[model samples]
Target: MLGRRHLLGTTAGAIATTSLLDRTRAWAQQQPFQPEPGATLRFLRWSRFLEAEDRATTENIRAFSEATGVPVRIDSVWQDDVLPQLSVAAGIGNGPDLAWTLHSTPHLFADKVLDLTDVADYIGGKYGGWYPLIEQYGKRDGRWIGISNLVIGVLPVYRVSAAREAGFDSFPTDSDGFLRLCAGLKRIGKPAGFAFGRAPSDGNSFCHWLLWSQGGRLVDENNAVALNSPETLRAVEYARELASHFIPGTIAWNDASNNSAFLAGQVSLTNNAVSIYGKARADGMAMADDIAYANWPVGPVGVPTELHLVYPFIGFRYSRYPNATKALLTFMLEGPQYERVLQSSAGYVSQALHAYDDSPVWRSDPHITVFRDVAARGRPLSYAGALGTQAATAFSEGIVADMFAEAIGGQVSPREAVARAERRALRIYRS
Candidate 1:
């Protein structure tokens, strides 16, 4: 916990005493990285859900620019658009010099991205260290291709009154109770909904949880296709039942659809990030007081099998100002700058580094506290298999999500859907 006091406390007529500040200063003195003359940096990131977060990031970029005397151009796009744009940039060896990419994206373009091991090592040593699961997302072949930064926690957000009406004293902790709750809600006319379409974060988060919670996986640890199995059939069957209780048009829902439906009171429950709650409170919506969050229900696996969105700061190897890019990345993760962004996010984004666990933001509100352990409790996108090009390809193509959607939409039987998903996984894994 890098508290605000530690970050702001200054020695008599001297610099701040923060360990990150002191260590970074020491490292700079020992091996100063000189930026190329006339270097400018371009950074692309997903547009923020919280306005304060965006403002804080802009401030950090401004401070970095002022300190380094290097002007930086920052661009933001919709969350789903980032990977496709980054893929194009990687393929053509041109575009933004750096980007904050989502899950397993760095793995997909590992060869096109700069090796960030040195940058990762510096930050990890100065801070507590990266969370355990971060290595799975940021590293490949023992080389760090990106700096795992923040995790967007996807959890169950529901209206408290609705849950009470559903006859549950609290949110369910297991799969069977969860289904009953949903069924109860639907009978009462406030059904729960989860994105089943091509939502980059929400769709993958919910669909992957459905599969993993039931002990189904796209691949085995050996990276063999494993989607066509009894476990997968069970998951699809469960999805079919679950989708029947969902609001209509969920099969076409994108990342923003559930957010819209939830906020508009069209759905009483949905799996989403804390941004929905943040938006409710920020806009003074009446439902803000009715909103509460809960951890995803445990399934037959008997452990937490949730997936979350991870943002990694990756620099392109083709960047003209590699040193400057590295410098900017290091600057952002420094305690003061990073802490401000986290604080402003209000727990919508969990820290990727373990040291920030005690940050005041997580404790600021009880409703948001459920997000604090996301990085610790959640699995990587490539769970039960290696995180690499193959896994990235399968995830990006949404094979698992599509399988659930296809089955729920009655385009195929559950078994057929599982077989189709397995066939798709085989194509990618065997390629």
Candidate 2:
């Protein structure tokens, strides 16, 4: 049963009222291979992740069925709107046999999930490679609960030709220079100089790096909240300043929104996932002469900029077929399935070790090379402590979004927003 609070908070409440199990059971039983004569394998994943166009994730599953002679079942669920409901389902032991989610999710389902350390070890030793970034995030208290097959990061993408025309030799080297560059572009009438997206998550993600760049810590080793520090305020102020030059429709932008603006030549430069590069190329957005990539700019901390990555979190509590679950994950990591997922989608990079070698995915593409370079120096946001997801959600949906709004709205001073956010953040930490 969905809690009243859960009902009031999200659309998941509505899904809870529907009958999900009967449909799932029937679906699972209908698949080609039954690992056990009486058992079936069901996969709960983001529908968008296994899109009709994203043939790799699907094909890999199909190949798994063929190779292992075990039938695979898929249940596509949207990550953002439906994951909470799925979490509820998992807690009650009704979740899918295999799950796909962010690195932070397994903690929420920790007890209900299998510790994948042994499985990861078994697979990595026998199968061959694993994504370095995914492998790192899969650990909790030094145990692996999931294996992320996809390791994706964001980079600052720019138009070298347009940047040069704006009287810049290259993209600015630091956050201040980047701000000045935006201001310069506005002075010359580019209208949109920078893109810090307005979605709750995007706002939070961009600010994390911004704060880090300015030497701001959201939390310290003592597990105390640190958003109120002066350095963090300055970082907020800088983002506020840059927000002023965003494309007219930026506030309405979600993750994919900026990509369209960039492809249409409405913005000069912005940070984005490498996958967008594939979209631009597909749309014929002028490759040879227009696009380029760079490390997202450094800030006051002189820190290397990094984009937040989402890793796959698999659990065991809901899986009736543990051996099959292990088998599927093993297949994802060490087999041809890994390479297939990389090439299955445009700009989808694999997380497998040394997978980039001799692969047309990287070798033939110059734009991708830029991202590969950035990944080498990237850092995960400080995982303050115990409640990684809650802390992350608060920072993103609350502090960052609120400060960014105040900055863009020009209502409260950025400093005021920062101070207010600090107080609120402290509450989150203390709670």
- Top candidate, metric TM-score: 1
In candidate 1 the C-alpha lDDT for residue 417 amounts to 87
Reference-based lDDT, residue 70, model 1: 80
Structural similarity to truth (TM-score) of each candidate? 0.89, 0.82
lDDT by candidate, in order shown: 0.87, 0.63
Please give, for residues 1-431, the per-residue lDDT of candidate 2 as tens digits: 98988768667634532323333344345433335544568777776742533565665566566545578888776667446866677767886788877546666666778777866776566555554555555667788876766656666777777677767888777888888777766666664433344553344456566767787766776667767778877777777778776666565567776666677777767666765576767667565346777777787666575645666658566677876776666666644556556655435443445444445566656767655543355554543344365555564455655665666666677778777777777777677
Q: Candidate 1 lDDT, tens digit per residue, 133-203?
A: 88888888999998877888999999999999989989999999999999999999999999988898889
RMSD (CA, angstroms), candidate 1: 5.4
**In angstroms, how far off is 317's CA in candidate 2?**
1.9
Name model 2 segments beyond 4 Å from true. 1-38, 49-53, 125-136, 191-202, 350-359, 373-375, 381-389
Question: In candidate 2, what residue range of length 10 has the lowest lDDT sum?
Answer: 16-25
Clashing pairs in 1: none
RMSD to the true structure for each prediction, in A, is 5.4, 10.7
- Clashes in each model (backbone N, CA, C under 3 Å)? 0, 4
Candidate 1 off by > 4 Å = 1-34
